[model samples]
Target: MSTPTGFMEYQRELPADRDPLERIKDWQEFHKHFSDEQLKTQGARCMDCGTPYCHTGIELAGSVSGCPVNNLIPEWNNLIYRGLWREALDRLHKTNNFPEFTGRVCPAPCEGSCTVGLIGDAVTIKTIEQAIIDRGFDEGWVVPQPPKVRTGKRVAVVGSGPAGMATAAQLNKAGHTVTVYERADRIGGLLTYGIPTMKLEKHVVQRRVDLMEAEGIEFVTNTEIGKDITANELVENFDAVVLCGGSTRARDVQMEGRDLNGVHMAMDYLNGTIKSYLDSNLEDGNYISAKDKNVIVIGGGDTGSDCVATALRHGCKSVTQFGTHAKAPLERDSINNPWPQFPNVYTLDYAHEEAKALFGEDPRAFSVLTKKFVGDGNGNLKELHTVQIERTVDETGRKIYSEIPGTEKVWPADLVFIAVGFEGPETPIIEQLGLAQDKRSNVKARYGKYVTSVDKVFAAGDMRRGQSLVVWAINEGREAAREVDKYLMGASMLP
Candidate 1:
């Protein structure tokens, strides 16, 4: 679109990152910035296809194929290419409430569905996106704009994570009074605690919250909804109550030595570290210390990888990540997963690379199942017994795994972190509200229509969708805000 250039002729590129070892020594973002000219070149790479599946944001063939928020990718790309940065930022902000967060942490499903990536590399969409928002911030173009009129309708959002924040912002923009309640000492939920600072600095999250506060959105921290403030109180005080509380009840590995002293959930470990860092530094020992310890992280998802990186930063002696499923292939795995959808492929993210540099080997062990944890006399975890396994599809084509006989062995470990993922939202609030739930324990609500069974009550984000990414959470929150506005006003202008 920029110059009618031939597709696939230009190479894909991304901004440079800090040296791995240097970045691991501290908990700060490691990505370097691209010049305005460089970002324009990247924006020029977008093919602007006829169908433009990148912005379609549809689920096809059982996986997400594009940006779930349905961002206007080509329009913004063309804007950036022509140096209309303010217009590009406005267009971007229209759909994504916080591109700064997504630009930093989102997995970028849009790139995965890019027509160009079907053959060669995808457009540098994520990098270009980050550049645009960062430029907007640096140029002082991003500012707080509180609504001119008030609907006098009050709304309560029960979590200050991405979903809650977006919901509050949209509702506030629609001239409703919005109050966000966060259980943590800080406003952000997992964004402030579960995610390590190296990936996303807390100060960046604080900046957005500050802006929201300036925009007439109220935030209440260190207040649990069901415990400190009753759900009934919220319903009575606010015109509508929208639950954006995340799915944070962690799943545990019920095995021998699970009650041992050194065993901890990934959220607990991550939150402890963040609390310690915020309180002062690690010297106070308020957080779980991996220093001089052999850490064995269970599960191979992003949480496990985060544990590996956090341990390394704490100066751990050794770190290992165990996975029950076989390693994904470097290329597309078409037999199990199809094309034009998210392909199950191996990717070396930042954490894995950090572990490799620190230990001289990648920390992940594929197809290795933990049988039990071995503990010392003091009830501290000492070793883990595991067996390598294979997986096969059942009659329903669901993936099932079984242990391979004669492969059992014990591995030494001083610290054991279970990063096996979350189950669903904590049931206390749901029960308190007397809302219906699905089989998975998630709050039951129709997609795109977030109204719950209870009158004037709505559920969105992980609370409604189970464990999901921040992007989806934001989408749910914004869409829920629209529905809530309509429910209260009989008609809605909010989007």
Candidate 2:
């Protein structure tokens, strides 16, 4: 620990967000940073317990409890508190390959399992992490370190998401020539298109890609494997192949009148928005427009929240989000739900806060289902038919729902966004490669081993485990690289 009286003397604090109303005007990030001294004081709040669950990185109660990448939380916290920022960044890079990405967008499971959180508030672990990495970049300490030796082994990593990037970076460090192939116009996969710009900037993603490229990892964007480059060609040419193609199949809602012009997948809308932002300032008119229209987003996950924020920036007249399940509890029930696991409770995100400030109410409705979408004669979406639902626990302890009688209602909506969830990775590559698949349609691969049925062909991240957090993807990436290295050279020096 940095100080003997740290936890007792100081309280937990985080950087304040910019005013919601002003922030909603543009797509810039909302956080107003704190001074280095304030961040050090915040870092001092860490208890640094003997078994610090903050970095356990495991699922305790059906949800993530701590850092999945297993970031050295307490060690870095103490380092920051002691004013050893460069050293703190070094420790951070030991586990997570990309602190900048996690610091900006990760949900920060570390705070949920913080020992200090057992009673009082948790340490500002996420803020401290962001501060440390951002400072490293600002001070010009972070640089490209290419491996001095070459093993003459060439590896091909398909899908340049978190997993592929991590695997490629690690393999290259182990003196292997690694090449990452991306299908999109730019690298970073969802980091480039799927995510809204306000949350994670595109340049940040490009900067990391550029750094990795400088470190001798070849990034071939717009050159998709199994399409432009054949899968068999890769397997025949490279020493080994790793499939990190993320889960891209969006879970859709099937209802009456599902086909409509204004209705779109959340990723479709988000991807188009980012592409338009990057291609030009929406000048091409190729993107979906919610301007001066009522927008209704289905599903209440982070993607749904992102849709709400994106619509708000597009000058939507009104926005509302729907969830099939009932509202979550305001406070965690300590008796039934204990600590060391992420709490299941109500929390307002950035978009919801802005919606409340602008619309005079929270734009979320729970225990409701959209029965059908009513459209105009021109195939344009116009209204939504919905009904309230009641939730009850089944004998097997599952929360099931049924429509409530005499509670049907109709609401006007000009645009509809489906943000339900994802099913699994797309099947073209898996099918072409003849890789075995799980019942859930995910690529069949062992967790630690990450080897597919086909020899020398491995998989990781969403491709192997289905849709998950970025931190989890990075973890899968590193672990997968270790396994791949061992397969390649009969041993691996990677963690």
Candidate 3:
């Protein structure tokens, strides 16, 4: 341990976010990192618990507890405490192929299950992880290490998202010729399009993709299977195929005015915004502008919050987020979601902070469901009809929502964004491959096995696991690549 007094002696501290108003004016990262000395102290705060539940990454009652990739947390923390950043980054990259992405975006479960958090604040693990990778980039320690020898095996990775990127990188490092196919105009799938430039700048993703390209991994954009290219051709040409298509089918609100001109799915709005921003500096009349409009974003998840932030950037008049469930408590509620596990507590992201600053109040409305949407005569959405409901467990042990009879109300809204969630991967590619799908409509694959019903075909990421965070997608991709490499070579050394 770095500190002689151990974990309780030191305290938890993180970098502050930029001014909310200033950050809302542009699409750029608002978070600032801690200084080197501060990071070292934060690292010293880790107790290096005997059990080290942070890296266990296990499911204890239907929920994941720690880092899914089983990162060597304590070892890296100690390394950082000693200012051994290069070594810490080495350990980090050993388990995670893309720490730069995860370090920035991941909802760090490792910190949630932290032993220190039970009594005191959790260790600043996420900040340290980001610092290590940033140092690696700054010190020129992170370079592409191409395999000295080629195995002559060819692999096709469909979808250039995190899953396909990780799989291709690992497979290429294992001496296989890997080619990633992306249907979009660019590689990096959601990283390039779905995610806004504010939270995760697109250049960061491009830099990593460039490095992967230098390592001899081929990226082919604007080429889709079963349409532009055939799945049969892929199976016949390549030794193996890994499907990484994400869950893109947006869960929409089924209401009367959903067909109105101003109503749109969250993905379409965000994707269009990112695409237009990337296409040319968000030119006038660029795709999906929300200028001077009253925007009502339905749903309470990250996507809904993103819509709020994006609308603010576009200078929307107002923003509101609707949630079916009641507001979460600020502190941990063990009976609902126990400790040493992901706490379902209230935490505000960048978007919500901006909304609070500009709108003079939080934009969240809980326990309210949109019954129908109101639209103007010109086919543009105008408002929303909603009602509050009480959540209770009904007979047969199922959660039921009961509407309050007199709670119906209407709110003004010019643009309505449906940001509920995703159902599953788009069916075109799945149907093209004729892959077996689970009841949830995800590509069928055993959790650890990752092997599909068909031979020489593997599935991973959102396509296999359904909608999840980028970190989980990367882990699934890496693990799936290992399984695919083993299947092809009958015993591989690449990790």
In candidate 1, stretches whose alpha carbon ends up further than 4 angstroms from where it belongs are none
Better of 1 and 2 by lDDT: 2
Model 2, runs deviating above 4 Å: none
Best by lDDT: 2
Q: Per-residue alpha-carbon lDDT of model 1 for 220-249, expressed as tens digits?
A: 998999999999889999899999999989
What lDDT does the true structure give each of the candidates?
0.88, 0.90, 0.88
Worst 10 residues of 1 by lDDT: 1-10
Give the lDDT ranking, best first.
2, 1, 3
Predicted candidate 3 versus true structure: per-residue lDDT over 25-95, tens digit per residue: 88898898899889889999888788988888887766678898888888899999898988999999999
Kindly report which residue pairs in candidate 3 clash with one another: none
Clashing pairs counted in every model: 0, 0, 0
lDDT of 3 at 307: 92
In the range 1-495, model 2's lDDT, one tens digit per residue, is 877678889877778999999998888889889998998898888877899999999988688998999999999999988899899999999999899899988999888889888888889988888888889989999899999999888999999998999999999999999999998989998778787888898888888998999999999888888889888888989989999999999999898778987889999888888898889877887788889999999998999999999999889999999999778898877976689879778989999999999998899999889999988988989899999999889999998889999999998999999999999998878878898999999999999999999888999999999999989999999999999889989999999
